[model samples]
Target: MFDVEFVVDIINKSGSSVEVKLDDQAKKFSQIGLDSLDMFNVFIELQDATGKEFSDDIVENLVSISTIVEFLNS
Candidate 1:
């Protein structure tokens, strides 16, 4: 059920200063101005929203909305 729009919504609501959009799906988190803490919060929010947990290995590669959507659907 996870999609780019869903991911973008969560990212935007995760308290990050930067606002993410569907066009930014291929962009890196850092390129969008998301710091470590922002990413941490995003992940936590994502886990809570999706009712799914990510392992360290998976989290390491989740650097973009495209990847996150792929991982979540996989």
Candidate 2:
């Protein structure tokens, strides 16, 4: 259980909404039609939305939506 809903909204706003699932977390962002910049944008939006700061390490682990939720909830 994590901030999946918030992350989904971010993903949607980032550009595309591809119906992310826990299983998608193990795959790369491109696998779901997003690029690295889009992911970075999502993180930036997240930072703005939650007032939380994220490190570069978060990007490394953000290969999938599950990982994004994990990092957001963290």
lDDT of 2 by residue, 3-74 (tens): 666677677776554555545656778887787667777878878887778788657767777777776676
Alpha-carbon lDDT, every model: 0.92, 0.71
Q: Which ten-residue region of model 2 has the weakest summed lDDT?
A: 15-24
Point out where model 2 deviates above 4 Å. 16-26
lDDT of 2: 0.71
TM-score (C-alpha, index-matched) for candidate 1: 0.95
Instruction: Give the top-scoring candidate (lDDT).
Output: 1
- In the predicted model 2, the residue pairs found to clash are none
Candidate 1 residue lDDT tens string, 7-65 = 99999999998988899999999998888899999999999999889889889999989
